[model samples]
Target: MLTGYQVAVIGGDARQLEIIRRLNEWDATVYLAGFDQLKEGFTEAIDLDFDSDQVERLDAIILPVAGTDDQGRVDGIFTNRLLHLTESWLKRTPSHCQIYTGISNDYFTQLTSHINRNLIPLMDRDDVAIFNSIPTVEGTIMMVIQHTDFTIHGSKVVVLGLGRVGTGLARTFAQLGAHVSVGVRSSASAARVYEMGLTPLDMNNLAEEMPECDIILNTVPAPVVQAAVIKQLPSHAVIIDLASKPGGTDFRYAEKRGIKAMLAPGLPGIVAPKTAGRIIADVISRLLKNSNREVDGS
Candidate 1:
């Protein structure tokens, strides 16, 4: 249990609600920073603004999945008010205070480094990524169904990158009766794709497969699907770039060719916030419990 522990959940969407629920169940004293628009209230959680002097007393500070932007502006789905995680505010926190975010950026890393504070990126953990893949694949399938005119069965699908999400998507699509081809950077990944009874293509030769691809799912963060690649795709082809913002696909080129191209990031949160939140809450509680025990020398 997180009894007596003071945690500040800064800003987030619906998933934050489940995180708050888990924290309250553990008996943590949660301070909410940017939830003014939320109607629900927790028995143990208190709504507090960023300017509150009490913010410095936190044992842990949890930011949204996206965390702060390049300018330190925190994303708050619950509030219209601008929230920023300033360096001064961070520096004032207790020496033992740890900050937890889904992903870290230059602003977070540099500021935390200069302040000598610990920052945990939850998405960096393997368990979190693997668990997240389930919802991502489901959401991808949903989107494909909604947008495409034809059935997934007998469709030609190509998945870029053999990472957690890519692997799950490729296998699931293949199981659904689609001919799945995975694009991998390394030969070993290709071998694994073949072992899974799926076709494997070199990332460099991705264009060769584009003309026949009915659905293209890109998990690679780099610009692997350029104008040259999009030029070879059929006009009816749909490209779902699941990479981070400004995804791997050439959106402009795809548009010029009249191909359906979409950039979808954070599909897990959009499609299944409850499940995603539970995954986050489970990992976070474990970390907090371990940390609490260490502090008490237990």
Candidate 2:
């Protein structure tokens, strides 16, 4: 139980609700900020201003999956008010008050470092990423079916990146009878792709591969599918860039060429928020439990 432990849940989307519910069930003193517009019948947690004096008593601070933007603006779906997490605000928290977010940018990292507080990026963990890949693949398949006229069977599909999400996407499409080919940079990944009975191509030399593909799924965060690559694709082909915002595809060029392209990030949260939220809540609960044990010298 998180009894006597004080947690501040900052701005977030639907997933934050699960975290708050889980923490409250564990008997933590939960405080909410940046959720003035939310009327979800929250009874266990108390709402507070972003920079309330009670922040100094916090044992942990939970942020959304996106965390703060470049300017420390927290993403709160429930509120229109601008929420910012300044370095000074973080400094007010106790020394042991750790911040947990799904991902972090340079600005967030710098803020935590300057305050000498631990910052945990949950998405960076393999367990979380692998678990999240299940929902991501499901969402990807949903999009592919919705957007494309052709069936998955016998369609030429190309998946970029052999990471957790990429691997799941490649395997699922291949299993669904699509001719799945993965863009692999390393020889190890290429061999693994081959072992999985799917073809692998050089990620850098993707120009030739685009023309035959029915669906192009990009998981690489960088600009892999540029204008040069998009121009080679069949006009009927659909591009689903699953990387983070501003995905790997050239959106302007794709639009100009009349090709359908979608930049879809955080698919799990979109398609299956409850499952995704539970996954995060479990991890966060365990982490806090461990910290609780440490504090108790048990």
Candidate 3:
């Protein structure tokens, strides 16, 4: 249990609420920031700002899954107020205080480094990524169905990057009877694709191979689908870039050629916040178990 522990959960959407629920169940004293519009009150959570006394005694800081944007502002749907997390504010946290976020940025990296504190990036964890792929793949299928008139079965689908998301998508698409083709940077990933009974195309051959692709799903975070590859694609091909923001597609160029391209980052949060929230809450609660125990000892 998180008894006697003071934790501040910063800006986030629905998933953050589950984290709050889990924390409350563990008996942690939670200070909620940027949730002023929350209709239902959590029995154990009190809405407070950084100026409150609890901020100094905070044992942990929980940030949104998206983390802070490039501008250092944390996104908060529940509150109208703009919450900006700054270096000076974080410096006031206790030395052992840990800040948890899904992804890290330049500001977070530098601030944590200068302050000599630990900032946990949840997205970097394999467990989180693997679990998140469930909702992502579901949402991807839903989008594909809604956007495209054609059926997935027997369709020529090309998936870029054989990472966790790519691997899952490929296998699922194959199960749906779609002709799955995977593009991988490394030879090992290509071998894995072949083992899965899916066609593996190297990055060098993407342009040549994309002409027959009906559904182009890009899992690579870098620009692998350039104008050259874009030009080779059929006019009816749809590009689903599941990488981070901006994605890996040449969107403007795809548009010029009449290709449908979309950038989908936080699909898990969008499709199933409760399940996504549970994934985060489970990991975070396990991590905090020790910290909460230490607080009890202190």
Candidate 4:
């Protein structure tokens, strides 16, 4: 049990509640920050401020999935006040204090490096990404239904990137009778796409494949469906860019072309927060438990 271990849960969305609850159940002394307005009823944890003393006592610092933006400002949906993770703040924490976040930015990485603290990016892990693909596919299907008038059955769908989300979503679309075509850059991935019984197209040939597709889902973080690719697609085509910020599609061109384009980053959190929370909470609890063992030298 984490009876004497102190954990500070910083800004986050609905999923943070699950983490707090799980940590509390494990007997950790928890501090909630950047979440003053949150209606979290976890009695074992304390709703606290960003006091320096608290930071020094913290064994672990939990940050949001998105972590800090380019400017090092965290996304605090629970409170109106801005939550910033600065270099000075890390300096206040103890030497062994480690930070946990889902995904991080270059700015936040630099700060953690300077402080010589362990910055764990959970989303980068295989198990987390694979499990996350379930809700992500479900959320994508929801978006496909809401945005498009056409049925999934017998519709031409192209999924860019044969990665975790792309592969899962493509298989689902194919199972639903949508003619699923996967786009990939690597020959090995293309061979795997063929083995899955889905048509695979190289990213270079996307312009040729664009016009026939009724719906285009891009999982690639890079600019794959820009001006050239957009020009190739039918004006009535639907685009769902699931990449992080500034997604893969050209928003300006899509708008000008009168095509429907959606940039959905954290689909799992939005569509199935409870399930997503549980997934994260399970991983976090195990990590903290292991860390506790390490501290106890057991």
Candidate 1, run of 10 with poorest lDDT:
289-298
Per-candidate clashes come to: 0, 0, 0, 0
- The digit string of per-residue lDDT tens for model 3 on 1-298 reads 7777788888889888888998898888999889888898787688766776667888889999889887678878888987888777888888878889998888777878889878889999998989989999998998898788899998999989888898889999999999998998788888899999998898876776664888988899898999999888778889999998879999999999999999988889889989999999888777776663385665
Q: Higher TM-score: candidate 2 or 3?
A: 2
Q: For candidate 2, write residues 1-298 as lDDT tens digits.
A: 7888889888888888888888888899999887888877689889866556898888889989988898888878888876788888889988888799999999989989988998999999997899999999999999999999989999999999999999999999999999998998999999999999999899868876554788999999999999988888888999999998878999999999999999999889889888888899888878877774456643
Query: For model 3, what is the alpha-carbon lDDT of residue 136?
Result: 90
Query: Candidate 1's C-alpha lDDT?
Result: 0.88
Q: Estimate each model's TM-score.
A: 0.95, 0.96, 0.94, 0.94
Mark the 10 consecutive residues where model 3 has the least summed lDDT. Answer: 289-298
The Cα RMSD of model 1 versus the native structure comes to 1.6
Pairs of colliding residues, candidate 1: none
lDDT comparing candidate 2 with the true structure: 0.88
Residue 163 lDDT, candidate 1, scale 0-100: 93
lDDT on C-alpha atoms for all candidate structures: 0.88, 0.88, 0.86, 0.85
The per-residue C-alpha lDDT of model 1 at residue 89 equals: 85
Candidate 2 has which clashing residue pairs, if any? none
Task: Look at candidate 4 and tell me the lDDT of residue 223.
Answer: 90
lDDT of 4 by residue, 1-298 (tens): 6777789988888878877877788788999878778764667778666655788788888888888888778777888876887788788887778788989888889889888988889889877889999999999999999998889998999999998999998999999999999999899999999999999898977776654879999999999998888877777789999998888999999999999999999898889877887888788767766774466753
Candidate 4 steric clashes:
0
